[model samples]
Target: MKPLYRGLASATRRKASRFALETRLDAMTTRLKDVGEFGLIERIRRLLPGAPDVDVIVGIGDDVAVLETGGGSYLLATCDCQVEGVHFLWDTTTPFELGRKAAAVNLSDIAAMGGAPRWALVSLMAPQEILVESIEELYRGLGGALAEAGAVVVGGNTAKSSEGLIVDITLLGRVAPEHLLTRSGARPGDVAAVTGTLGDARAGLELWLRPESGVPEEEARTVKRRYTSPQARLLEGQCLGRCGAVHAMLDVSDGLLSDLRHMCEASGVGVELEVERVPVSPALPAVAAALKADALAWALTGGEDYELLFAVSEKDFPRVADQLLQETGTTCRAIGRFVDRDQGLRLILEDGRRSSFDAYAGGWDHFKAT
Candidate 1:
């Protein structure tokens, strides 16, 4: 207890030092009412500057920052948002974790597009109760995730709000024009593939929401870690992009079924998802069984896995899977295939039962919150 208290005290002092000179005048008093939205944004913009060496035609001051890049490369852009209650629980999630989530979610979108994330703009809206130190920690998390994805946080807006916190990230990247992959590229007979396992993050979220499920300490911590820190499949996506096998790609932000439906709809095709072929994280079954939850449903509907879901030509499936495993150490497997448009999106159960799956929960809609 003594050592823990000492460490916490030291952390508090360090946090204070980190913001020694950046105090807002109304911070200690009633909420910063005088600092208008634009004033707060200007303060944040002043603190965050653009990266050196990047060609900047238009930076931060306009409606959208435009960039001049060498021709022959395709432009890839993705936007994602994280909200307090919907995406995270304030009591369980750290500021640093929140920041990483903000960035990684957007980077996952870039990965889904089969591009390398080059830059990001992070816009944050939070209640006045959030401390300056926490905000800095959030940026640190964002920086760490950006570094991992080979992206830079160029600029963004930050302002106080009485409502719940929100972090919106827009990521921009480039890939060889020929290498660009979108959800609209899947075709009949194309093989469906996924990077890494699914359901781990969903299991983690369940553990987080209900801690009394009798999970062992180590297992519980692992689940909690997955919920807090999900890695974007940037390297895997890049490798797949270079492999010339990927056709259509998307991040599994919603459950596998939902995201797959998205790709199918966009591509003007239908898909047959094999239940047995879907890879479940090793921890998923045990955790779900203990909680009396359906593991398959969890994997099918779980969000925040951040894994890449892609389609490839049938002839390229084996080679693509081999290269992806060798290059990124992430497992890639064919889960299904694109079928005729009339077949629609169908899920084949283990018992050989088939049914159409229509998921109501789209990818993180704020207005649909319970």
Candidate 2:
């Protein structure tokens, strides 16, 4: 009887110890919202085993992971995911538009690396109640967008989700070794330029959210088109790479200021942005006025523009800009210049006053709690 009691007591103690350990783990486990998307990515990167191979030219940090194929060219791979409620509203955009956007976003990353998109794989998550016709329309849009970029849908997967829809696309591209642009090549005095205008998409989103915002019909349509169907600057990026002038390049999917900061950080440099030099579509100002918001603010912090943001040597900027404009018929503007790291990121006002760029910290963080 004594031995039996001792055995039971020991078993109880083991159960208690296990429960305490689990409790402690629950307490120590950090929520993803607290860490944010970038922080979570950093943590995951730290957890990943180190790869010392030279074939992995760029990994984890940049827009795309560049791999040396030893075939005189480098391969670029990138992927992007879009959530239904988070990235778009069902009422605001159709399934077709969402599919196109998912593909375009991934292609934009490939373009940012000065590569031409060749193939894509799309994975989708949807509810069982989702209409089959809607899914077909979505595929049609995806097919069209890929065809435009000369990319094909090679393979993908589908799963039923309990919640909102999810579309993820992985794109593969190629770039010449000499023309492989990255975010680490910018230097002090390099001119920062962007292809096409900014803020139109943000303004369009605002209008979509606030239909009664009194935006003109024509202007609203134009801005909404910009949002629903963003054109990736694929040709422009290839031209920039071939021109031998672009130092570093990235796409403006994360807002101009945020993406520019990414370039500066990777290059260990800073930036001085001329606020007035930032380009905006003709429709953005009216939309801003109707919403009583700053047009420049949208241009600075709004994401999903998908334009090319690149740095070029000051001497080569004019020739590069001219050539790009001539070749693509896209408006290219030099909105800023790189500075030394100690100088810090800044924004120059119209009155010739410079201020620390504290007004806008970042664009979109996926793990942020609303």
Candidate 3:
């Protein structure tokens, strides 16, 4: 009887010890918000299934995945997601604009890869109480944007959610192997350049957010139009990719500095940005003046511009810039130049003074504190 009682006590002790260990582990586990968006993505990338197949040329880290399709062509695939409160305000934008924005975002990813969009698959999630007509309007907008890019939606999935509307689009595109532009190809001497203007979208959004801020009505409308209906540089991307002069290419969906850092990281190089050279639309200055904000700050950190930022070889930059302007009707300006990694990332201020870029090392992080 004594031996049996001792055995039961030992079993209970072991069970309690196991529970305590598990409780400590649960307490130690970090939350998603603590890690932030990029950190979470890095963890996901590490956990992803092993080495990709032979046909997979570019994988997780790029804007779009490049897969060999044979016949000297590669398939570019990318997906983007937009949530109601996070991406846009429902009251400020129509369903048509929302749909268009959704489609355009994914198309921009393909454009970043120098590919022509061909097909798309959309997935929508909305509450059951949502209006059917609103959904139809959204689809109409998506269709129009896709048509502009010569792409058609083949299929998609729909589901019911308890929260606000959600949209996800996956775009498929094709590009010649030689015309493929990636973030990893920029060398030390490449010129850093961008298309169209920067910060207009951000300025537009600010005006919309603060209508009483005394911004001109017409300028507000123009900037708001830019924010609502952003343009993807499809033609410019294709031209630059095929030109063989551009070394690295990406779209400025994130802030210019953030995206530039991405390119530098991938290429294992550094960049020096001439602050004054970053272009701003005519409307941006007015908006900045009214709001008492620095337009250059917006140009550096404002996002969702959907403009192309690429690095061109020094020898070919002049010709490439001229050809790009002629072919695409978009102004391509050399804003900076790539440098050896040891130089690190630097910003040349308007006063001709150099500053460490760490001060501006911030952008739209999904999990970052608002």
Candidate 4:
């Protein structure tokens, strides 16, 4: 384990900070548009904390940082940022809901590890025109969600942004050594499962993005609320982690296909997911139909539902799914199976087609054209 000291450079280590006004740069710097989000992340992984460091059980990747502080359990640190235009919009989401969703995403990361969230640090960057009452409501929503998970906000920072509002939260959690689960544990033949229904958030997103879709008022209300406020499966994740049946786990912020790809890459395995089993939310089909969109597509490639996705062995999945339902009152679905790394990511369509289809680009990429 690597010490946290090297995770960040010393304030005195350099005469100017990384964000110094007059920072120097190389002769040629590629634009972020060319590198893309994951590419930029890979470039950063090479420059930062150099994993295999002392006291750093996990670093630079996976959803959270698993640290060894000589404590009873490993410390889990994760953060997520919500931007106004990118994550939420004032036209559809209230400040309170925005705040709640921001906190929930980070909570989902901790939940993925089956860890207990203990604390949070929320930093906000907003423009001057924002109202104080809205911000207060936002914190009220954020603090409320944290309280539900036995976590609290210790402190954070506030800065004025020339652009849109940004709410970034860093959450810390703890997981006993025996209960810790990462994305790298799935073995071939393991069953891939997900908690709760999928695609509701995206349906909700569409309510705002495609107003002319004519989604009924009742259905419209349902999906929009889900999009505005996502619940993190903290209790379900903890139960699954302790059950000893789950092989690998993560939250579905990046959609089923994309996150499955992540799980496969991390576990050095591959996956084959069934189209019929993807667990589309009940609220999705009607909305998708109204919008003339594909509900299955939303279930596969839509992001930000905050559901937990895990892999369990074929023999254990039934028991694990049953126990999870009984313990947390949350339904779990086994939608896919892990395969050899050589198989890559394969999907089964309703017509009994298995493919690594070139046209079905997996999931959302910040830098890639959709």
Query: Considering every candidate listed, which one attains the maximal lDDT?
Result: 3
lDDT digits (tens) for residues 1-370 of candidate 4: 3446545766745665565433356436566667887888899988775546688887876999999987699999999999888877799888998888888999999999999999999999989898999999999999999999999999999877768999999999999978989988999999999999999988998888887787788888888877888999999989988999888999999887888888888899998889899887677999999988899888888888899999899999999989998999999888988999998888888899888834476777788644
Give residue 191's error in model 3 in angstroms. Answer: 0.4
Query: After superposing candidate 2, which stretches have Cα over 4 Å from the reference?
Result: 1-25
Clashes of each: 0, 0, 0, 9
Worst 10 residues of 2 by lDDT: 1-10
Check candidate 2 and list the clashing pairs.
none
TM-score of 2: 0.92
Give the least accurate 10-residue stretch of model 1, judged by summed lDDT.
Answer: 57-66
How many Å off is the CA of 56 in candidate 3?
Answer: 0.6
- Better candidate number, 1 or 2, judged by TM-score: 2
Residue lDDT tens for model 3, 111-211: 88889999999999898899999999999999999999999999999976658999999999999998999988889999999999999889888887888
Better of 3 and 4 by TM-score: 3
Q: What are the TM-scores, per candidate, against the unseen true structure?
A: 0.78, 0.92, 0.92, 0.90
User: Distance from true position, residue 232, model 4, in Å?
Assistant: 0.3
